[model samples]
Target: MTTHITGTREEWLAARLELLNAEKELTRRSDELSRRRQELPWVRVDKEYKFETEEGSASLADLFRGRSQLLVYHFMFGPDYKAGCVSCSAIADGFNGIAVHLANHDVTLSAVSRASLAKLLAYRRRMGWTFPWASSGDGRFNFDFNVAFTEEQQREGAVEYNFQRAGHAMDATPVPLPVAQSAAMTGTDATTYSLDRPGLSAFVLEDGVVYHTYSAYARGLDGLWGMYQWLDRAPKGRNETGIWFRRHDEYDRR
Candidate 1:
């Protein structure tokens, strides 16, 4: 009852070899893109953004933690939400494993959210994550990075996200079913949950000044989602029809 094409071992090896060449070419292109990303002009960050960490209140520069480079995952955990975004949690599950390696290489990887430090810490403990998570509670850091929006922006029907003005789920009159479901999971309303979006931003500290290097949002974050990277190479690829993922802890219970 197998629906897939049946192939002999010899035929499969020949096709796989052909695919290997294409994969190698893609790897080379990815390397070139990495070089271009590094070449992008750096914008100086003068705003005095503050975040509440497990240690204490810290400024934006202090986020680097004495490292020259800082990579921040803009986790979607708004002040109103009781929990983090499921999709974001899925992405963050991989952070702990690579965080120490990045730190050893002089890069500090952290997650920043609008949730309170206590809330973040509670969720971090539940997930058993050791990586640094900071709360931008009542701070402009998330808004400045375009990862968090305001009620006014939502009512206006379009918000600048992923570097472009686009319609947000919060703007939907009835609120999309998926958004409602995700909001409920976060223990918030759709409008409130939609205010926070997922993104990653890079910053560098040079000569006692912090500089913005780059940022990526939405699908741009796919590369960092390890599960998707693995699924991409699977026989069926990412065969998703709807929101089928959950926070890692929720999976066993489901």
Candidate 2:
């Protein structure tokens, strides 16, 4: 009754073998790209940025937590939002399990957001997550990192994200349905929701100084969306249409 191609075992194996060769080549190319990312110059971070953590006020360097490297997931929980962005929450769901492993390997993985420390901690408890989440707290940390934007920036088209000047889709008239829906879920309008974007930034500490290494945004974050990586190998393969994901806890509410 299936419409998919029916094949003998031999035929399927032959096709799979051909795909395996391509997959191997892709793996090698991915390795090369990673090496190139590591080779990118690290700019010294001299500007002081403060964060509010569960342990009280902390410096940007402190987030490294004795590790040489730090990976920050620029979470999209703006100061106004009632809750975190659904998409961001989905991406963060995988962080708890990997945090310990990355810590042992000398890389500290934490999430930085514009939300207050209290709000972040409450949400972490709601989601049952223990990964370090810090609040940038009305500081320029998010702006300097290009993950958060201002109302003026949005109005004047001064936003630069993913290393380029780009207009946010949420600004368009008749805002995209998914954007509107997500904004509603966050208890904000589309414009407010769009101000805070999601991204990942890397930093390194050496000789008692911290350096900004690399950052990615937009589709560049695709690889870090753990579900998509698994879905890519599934039969339906991401088969998405108009925001099919939600915060892991929301599914039961439906």
Candidate 3:
């Protein structure tokens, strides 16, 4: 009684072959886009941003960690939050696996957050992640990168996120359900949680100078979320409802 299509072997092969052609075309397009991304102009970073890492304090350049390139995952863990954003945690679960590979390729991968070093370390330990994570709690690094915002920005309704001035969830009188859920999971209210957004930033150190190479926010980060990449190839392609994910540890309990 299943409503799904039931076809002969030959029919299935024909349909799959048609889909294969489209997939190949998409792959070529993705490659070209990547080439264009690398060609984008780099902006020099002059700000003396500092971060609290496990090895005492570190500078933005030091994050390169003897590598020429740095890829920072701007994790959504605000100073006030009790936990990291669940979605961000999900994305971060893949980081530890790839961190060593990227380091060997001369690119250092890291996660930066506004949470305190102690808090970050505690959560990282709970998750059993070995990747380098830094706390930007006392620095303008997160704000400068457009990943973190202030209360004033939320109140004034002048926040520019995802490359445009959009109405933030923090500004909404009644917080949206997804934002509320995420906030509660982070052990914060909607407003405090909304102050932090998810993003990825790329940097390069050349001639003793750090250059901002590229950044992606919101859906632009989808390509890097390993789980979703697999789900996209599944039969139902990210068949999502409202906030269906949890921090990896929470899933088993649920």
Assess each prediction's global lDDT (C-alpha) against the native. Answer: 0.91, 0.93, 0.92
lDDT of 3 at 100: 91
Model 1 regions more than 4 Å off: 167-174
Task: Report the lDDT tens digits of candidate 3 across residue range 174-218.
Answer: 778888888999999898899999999999999999999999998
- Candidate 3 clashes between residue pairs 3 or more apart in a chain or in different chains: none
Q: For candidate 3, what is the lDDT?
A: 0.92
**For model 2, how does the per-residue alpha-carbon lDDT over 1-254 read when each residue is reduced to its tens digit?**
99999999999999999999999999999999999999999999999999999888999999999999999999999999999999999999999999999999999999999999999999999999999999998999999999999999989978888787765566567799989988998999999999999999999999999999999988899998899999999998999878888888888774
lDDT of 1 by residue, 169-200 (tens): 54467878878888888999888898999999
TM-score to native of every candidate shown: 0.94, 0.96, 0.96
Winning model by TM-score:
2
- Sorted on lDDT, best first, the list reads 2, 3, 1
Total colliding residue pairs, candidate 1? 0
- True lDDT of residue 234, candidate 2: 99
Candidate 3, residue 185: the lDDT equals 96
How high a TM-score does candidate 1 get?
0.94
RMSD each, Å? 1.7, 1.4, 1.6
Give the poorly placed runs of model 3, Cα more than 4 Å off.
Answer: 167-174
